[model samples]
Structure formats: C-alpha cells, structure tokens
Target: MSSNLGKIDVEVEVKSPVDKFWNGIRDSINLFPKASPNEYKSIEVVEGDGKSVGSVLLIKYTEGFPLVTFSKEKIESIDEANKTLVYSVIDGETLKYYKSFKGTLTVIPKGNGSLVKWCCEFERANDEIPEPQIIKEFAVKNFKNLDAYLIGA
Candidate 1:
C-alpha cells in the first residue's frame, strides 16, 4: 500500500552494565557470530592496525536470491566511543533488492540495567513490503539473541 518503507527500531534491556556490553560488541571477532548470525555469518580480520579503526573485517552475511543465505560485508567504520559499528555491503544477495542496510547497536545506561538499542535501515527498490509484522519478528528475535548472549556472558 505504501511505497515508502518505515524504519525498524528495537530496544532490549540487559542486566549487564553499559561498559561491559559496549566492550563485548566492539569486539567483532568475539561477538559478531554470537549476537547476529543472520547478518554477520562470520567476520575475518584481513589487514589494518590490528584491533583499531581501519581494520578490514571481511563479513559473511545473508545473500542469494529466491532463497537468500550469506554474503560479504566490509567493516566501513568502527567507533568505540559511541559503541557503533557501521558496515557497508560489499557483496550479498540481500543487497540486490534491499539495496543497502546500515545497522547500529547502542547501549544506554539506565540506573542498574542498560538499554540496548539496535536498528537497521534498508532501502527498497520495489513497493513490496513483505508484511509489516516481519519487521517486529526480526527485531524481537535479534534482540533476544543479544540479550541471551549478554546475560550468559
């Protein structure tokens, strides 16, 4: 009905502190596979100042048409101060129609617990918006995955 796509934003509260959760996410090699499996199939460090910004991280994510599965995403930017990891799509099936996707994971402190806000923005070429509920479903599942991982750690 609407060609303009809406944004998908989801937030989850973790028992862990902000600093701890922030550190966990900033470490892509350690946290990528666990926190987000669908997008980040795997992350491999290629070249850079090792651990610092400009480090090349080959990311394997969902790709393939008809039945999308996995592809590659290069680490475009990493900011530890704001606890943000921005990745640009290099090669992926999902990128074909989705065009582009920017994901951000942030932690906001609230008393003892912290609010883990995760969001993904996508650009669609067609007017096809596969069921609005799917967005909520994805958000819940993704956030739940992060919550479990944080609590267990």
Candidate 2:
C-alpha cells in the first residue's frame, strides 16, 4: 500500500430539504448527542459566540470499544448562503494524535433533498495515529445521524 497522508472526505445523501439539512448541521452541537446517544455523550459551547465564527465547542463521547476521547473545536466560519460550516481543533485530546486538524461540512441542494459533504484535513504527529481513517469514520457516522434526524428515521 502506498503511504500517503492527506485530507479525508465523506459525503451522505439526506432525504430532506436543503434548508432543513442545513439547520440540523448548524445546530449540530445540540443535535448530535440526541441523535446518536450511543456515540456522543454531550456537546457544549466552551467559549466564543455559540455556533458563529470563532466559537468553540467541547464534544464529549460515550465510552465504547474504540474509546473515543472528548474534543474541542473552534468554529472558523459559517456561511449561510453557501450552506457551509468550517471548524478547527484548538484544544483537545485530538491534538495529541495529530499535528493539526480542520473540518468542513457543506450542504448542497439536490433535487428535493440535500447532499452533505464532510472533509477533514490533518497532519499526523506520528505514524501511530490513524488520522484520515478515524476522521472519515467519525464524519460518516455523524452524517448518517443527521440524515436520520432530518428524515425522522
């Protein structure tokens, strides 16, 4: 296998209107724990102005086999017109595994529903950490939860 470390991207199709999908993503801090109680324990705004740009959120995870630790991500931007959200890891256990981490979520209108795209760009601190794979899995699960929430599934 070729050893190339880079950004990871995952996309999910939601059976809901673009606006509805965007709203769910915009309020992800409050929605995630409710949608996927088994994966996420809780989420709180630790600093800044909530979901707006510059805000920071602390995400707590439920204990499980993988043993995911909590993380703190700072909101870099939220574009309503384009339906995009950007954030970066500021202070969290994630930094211990990665040199730098940033995530972007974009919602695109498709027919009656929407397509949600999640992207994570990071540099691993060492070969031990599974940067892209772990990030990809996390994003996929979150995207599925958001899709289910929007469709009342």
Candidate 3:
C-alpha cells in the first residue's frame, strides 16, 4: 500500500505564560491521563531517564474501542532555549495506518500570553484512512484540554 504523506498544523493562543506552558508541554505524558481520563488510561516511562530527549513514553488507552491503541512515543528533541519539543510515534496502533508520525510543539511569546503551535507529519500506509486529519483534530482537542488544565480555566 502506498500513499502521499501529509502534515497538519494547529496553532492556538493560550492565556498562559511561556514558561508555564513549556512546563505543561514537558509534563504532558503525566498530565494528559489525568486531564483526559476518558481517552487515556495511563502513561509510563519505559526507556531513558524520563522526559528527556531520548526517553520513551508508553501510553495506554481507555477501554471500549473496537481497536484498542497503545501509543509509544520517543522524545526526539527538547530545546528549552527555544521552547520546542519534538517526538515521534515509534510504535502503536497508529502505525497500523501510518508509516511514520512525528509531532512537534513550540511555544512563542505573544503579548502577555503565548502562542502554541502543534504540528504533526505523517505518512499514511495507504489512502484508506485519513489518519493525518484525525491526528490533527486529536492534537487540537488535546491542546485545548491541556490549556484549560494549565490555567484552571
């Protein structure tokens, strides 16, 4: 199966400081399960020294889906100087539909708050499923959840 690759970018204005938003970005694995328990069951560090650049996160999903998907993301890069984070989905059910998936997050100072850009690049296994758009929507929703959780909004 062969199909063209796709990229999705979602940018949102967050009513939070860049430092605080960056902290939330770094703690996403632990915070996501707590904020969105319906979608995420748990996340555990399986490799490396935690959330650092080489670390791997094993994410378990909540029950009741026809296809239960587990996400294993490897932290590719973390640049605190630029407030940027990059991770790759090395394993999971998403790989069943995508040949590759890469997630990048950046926080830029905007006025008193911050502007967050969440981008995902994925190559589909075939043209059957629109995994790129699905992941994009998922990212946006999760970002909203994270923003709300961070600001207690």
- List TM-score per model, in order: 0.69, 0.90, 0.90
Taking the tens digit of each residue's C-alpha lDDT, what string does model 3 give over 1-153? 245588888998887788888888788778888767777888889998667988999988888423546989999999999999999999889888888989899999999889999888888887786756656666777777777888883
Error of model 2, residue 132, in angstroms: 2.8
Per-residue C-alpha lDDT of model 2 across residues 17-129, encoded as one tens digit per residue: 89988888888787888788888888898897677898899988888615457888899988999999999998767777777889898999998988888888887777777
Off by over 4 Å in 3: 1-3, 64-68
Give Cα-based local distance difference scores for all models.
Answer: 0.63, 0.81, 0.83
lDDT of 1 by residue, 43-150 (tens): 677666436655665656554212345545555666777776665555556566666666666777867867878776676656774523454565566556666787
- Estimate the Cα RMSD of every predicted model relative to the unseen true structure: 4.2, 2.6, 2.3
Candidates arranged by TM-score, highest first: 2, 3, 1
In model 1, state the lDDT of residue 77: 69
What's the distance in Å from true for residue 37, model 2? 0.6
What 10-residue stretch in candidate 2 is worst by lDDT? 1-10
lDDT of 3 at 99: 85
Off by over 4 Å in 2: 1-5, 65-67
Provide the global lDDT of candidate 2 against the true structure.
Answer: 0.81
Number of the top lDDT candidate? 3
